[model samples]
Target: MGGQPPAEPASEEYTVDQLAAKVGMTVRNVRAYAGRGLIPPPRLVGRTGYYGPDHVARLTLVRELLGKGYTLSAVERMMSELPDGALALGVFETLVSPWTPAEPEVITEQQLADRAGIPHDPATIAKLIELGIAERVDDGRLRIPNPDLLRTGLEVIKLGVPLDAIFEMLPKLFEQADQVAKIYVELFRNTVWRQFADAGLPAEGWPEIQRTLENIIPLAGQALVAAFRESMGREIETAAYEELGLPPDEFSSTG
Candidate 1:
């Protein structure tokens, strides 16, 4: 099946042992990732650490990447480049947090063909797998880890954006996003999370830490939206002015 994969079931809180089993990882490996900061520290509830949906998603993604032949050290380095909250949940999820639906759509291979305007394109499907957008499951159905990206790419293609251009641009976009994320994460880490960590991670401080972590997602999103809008507006204004043959000084400062 090459269609939209079914949404994963709602995530549940899991103990360390349960989480390890759920993700098909040995307990030792799970703990190893945690220690390496490849995953977030679990929610501390007394002596037991409880994991959440974010943890499950992160672990699954890590396993998938590893299965695709990424070395553990390479995966760890790539993951380490993500912003703090990003690693804890997922880089994709963090970037698309505002718009992501609670559940992903499920469609048949025929439906996917309809969307692509091709009944069966093995090369195209293979490219999708290479891009990490979709994967073929054990049952033979395709699973799209990031459906938003797939839909967006399809829309852009329909709009005449060449596939090659899209492919060429994705890596550049990811690099820029990662760079920007580091700036914000450093700001928060230095001023907030790092302090909490250095203080022995006292139980009483956990709520504040969690609250700050939760707030960072939306706050960073708002900043990104603002910056993009401002940049776009400037570009549009310049294009419009050039169209009218206006000099720079002919325009009054809008700001």
Candidate 2:
């Protein structure tokens, strides 16, 4: 008889310290997460505990959720209800990851001023930061989070719109955009996400949920742009008629 049939080779394993290092978490945090039941208890071999890939995936998921602005307690509740934490994490990421990735441009204060056609003053820099158009880095340089937005602002300025006016309009624009985004998000939440959650968040249903979300991503943007174009056309036509002192009926018939 062979000696206990040659001991099976161990799968990938990590001690508590090794697990923390592997997942880029502190040992204390790893223990804390375990205590919170966010991750399953480690396997005890003699007096020592070992963590495997599942723990690594769960910890990685928790970190990602926190980085995405989820509160710890909220993450806890979601983790607690998940049938397969790793798969759930993948679906959650697909749902929340940005549809468009923005590549930021870094420039000095003077360069930013030159591009924006504004003075290189503290007030202007502050305004840029306040409007979220730019951020100041540790090296005293500015970062344009969305260069396309900056280009649009410059184009608007070229149309004889003042920089101050653009700044003033941004807050209102943000509010309107937020409202529109909420409407779309609520539509999905009340329908797809709600149905999935109500069905006990079955593992088999995740793929369908993910597919619906991916489809909606581009469709939502297209629909929003189409609606905005129609509305803007109507508004511009009305304004032009008023400016030229034409009657509504005449404009409607000839516009």
Best by TM-score: 2
Q: How many residue pairs clash in each candidate at the backbone level?
A: 0, 0
For each candidate, what TM-score against the reference? 0.54, 0.82
Tens digits of per-residue lDDT for model 2 on 8-64?
Answer: 324788899999999899999999999999999888766778888888889989998
Local distance difference test values of all predictions, in order: 0.74, 0.84
lDDT of 1 by residue, 1-255 (tens): 557664333357788999999999999999999998878888775577888877777787778678768999988876665434324344344334554544555555666768866566667677767777778777666777767777988898788777778877877877898898889878887988688768866656655666666678788879998999999889988887898889868986566
Candidate 1: list runs displaced more than 4 Å.
Answer: 1-110, 118-120, 239-255
- The best candidate by lDDT is 2
At residue 93, candidate 1 shows an lDDT of 43
